[model samples]
Target: MQTVDKALKLLEFFRTDQPEIGLSDLARLAGYDKAATRRFLVALMGHAFIEQNPASRKYRLGAAFLHFAQVREATLPLATVVTPLLDALSAETGETAHASHYSAGALIAIGIRESSRANRVHLDPSEILPLHATASGLAFLAFGPAAPLEAAVDQGLRAYTAHTITDAAALRGAVAEVRRAGYAISNQGFEDEVVGIAMPFFDSSGTATGAIAVATPASRMSDELRVLILANLHKAALAATAGIGGIPAEAFVRAHGERRAA
Candidate 1:
């Protein structure tokens, strides 16, 4: 068990950016002797979870994780429910819509629906956004624990654009607004040229399991446009929340009725 834990620690050194690490660095990271680290890495290499660079001999994650990820994605109940909703929302609103989740303290865009309008907004799949820099992220942060939120704020809300929010007090006010309204919105906050809105979908524990959001070009997100989008957003948000399957048992019972007729 101890050896397994150490081996896993070595793998952790390779992340989204630094997807490769040398033997010496891996040894230090795992606090294991070089010889043992090499042996463990070789075993993992045999399993195809990590592969060695042909030229440098450094190690990076192999295709096994991707294979597992695909299988995992295929099994998620949300996939079936979200895709149809995203497509319908996009078709109706003529704007890009997406469903995202917060995992490992970051917002991951999991599903997308392209805008039907000639002028529209879009985000690449698998895009990761900082909690302080995006509507989906902020919606989660505002609804999530206080510690993670403050840590993210302290990590520096680097101004992404001239209009991006950087003042701590101002950002706090925005978060408060999200908490009150049960949603978050961005008008040129993350990207100066884009406007977006997001709200959380809570599981039965009242914990936010995921979020759904839509975006439009800055010009299309004007006062009148926002009104229309909000109406559509409200409908979609409620529907999405209702379909999310991970309800707490108590909440599930309440919704379905405590007693069932025979």
Candidate 2:
């Protein structure tokens, strides 16, 4: 188990911008003995999970990684499932709409649709939403499993901006509010200029799979605009949830019902 953990740690060293690492860098990053890192790399190489570059003596994630990712993607196909929702949401709200997937306790942007407007919020596929600082992360925390939320709090919350939630207790309180409201809102939490709203969608088993969000410039945020965005966002969330054969969080459904009744 320890060996497996170390080998997995090496994989984390590769990222979108830095896809390759040398043996010395890997050893330093792993914080393990150089020889141990070498052994792990050798084992990963044997399994084709990591490949070496003959020119630079650097290593990169190999074909097996892509194969496994393709297998998982083929089964779930999150991008294919969510892109249309993003497009519709962007059109309806006239704002930048994006969708993220929850994986290994992180919310990763899977798809995004930029509004036709020249000045719109921009999101890249590689962006990871901070659990304490983004609407998508807050929605997932509110509607998804409890373990990941607790683990994230345990790891500590780093403030990204003045509006970011830094206290663990405050973050819990914020998430509780999201549960009560049926959706999550982040006002300049992750970025000073952006205000975002998000709703979580569940998988076939009724587990929260991910979240979809619309982000607008703070200057454009008003009571009327917020209402408009949420209304369209709710419509998109429901359609996306149903299209994927997934479920909406019960609190969301119940709150929606109460709103209708009122």
Candidate 3:
């Protein structure tokens, strides 16, 4: 198990921004000795999970993930169901709308739709969102599993901006607020000039499996716009949850109804 963990950890270093890395750099990033890193890389190469470029002598992710992703999508088809919701949300709010999936303690951006406006927020699909710093993450902490919040607190919250909640107690309070409201609002907590409004979507078990979020420029987030985004976000979240064969928690359904009535 430890060996498997080490190999997977090494592979995680490859991202959209740093797709290729040298051996020494891989060792530095993995915090493993050169010999250990090389051994892991060799094993991964044998499995076609990592490959080396002959010209740059740098390692890159191999093609195995493509096959795995295809198989997973063939079975789940989450993006197919979530993308339209994101698009509609973006269109309605005139902001960047994104969807995130939570699995094994990670919140990953799975779908995104950019607003047609010139000054809209941009998102990186490859970025792993911090649970305490993003609206999606906070919404998940409120409505999803408790284990992620415990894990995040154990790891210690890293403040991305001055508005980010760093203290565990404060984060708990923020999550509680999200639970009460059935959604989350982050005011430049993750980024300097962006605000995120997110609603968690649940799975069949009535536990949140992901979130749908709208990100807008702070300068453009007026009161009327906030209301507009929230209304549209609720509709999107409901459609997405139903499309994915999920059941929203009773509390979330109740809160959503109250918001709509108001």
User: What local distance difference test score does each model get?
Assistant: 0.74, 0.87, 0.92
Give per-residue lDDT, candidate 2, residue 188. Answer: 95
Off by over 4 Å in 1: 1-47, 50-61, 74-76, 246-262
Worst lDDT 10-window in candidate 1: 253-262
Q: Which number leads on TM-score?
A: 3
List where candidate 2 sits over 4 angstroms from the true fold.
260-262
Query: How would you encode candidate 2's per-residue C-alpha lDDT over 129-204 as one tens digit per residue?
Result: 8888999999989888899889888999989999999999899999999888888999999998999999888877
Tell me the TM-score of model 2: 0.87
Pairwise lDDT winner, candidates 2 and 3: 3
Task: Give lDDT: candidate 1, residue 157.
Answer: 81
Model 3: lowest-lDDT 10 consecutive positions:
253-262
C-alpha root-mean-square deviation, each candidate: 7.3, 2.4, 1.1
Give the per-residue lDDT digits (tens) of candidate 1, residues 35-117. 99999988888888889999999999888988887787678556667788788877777789998877766777768998877
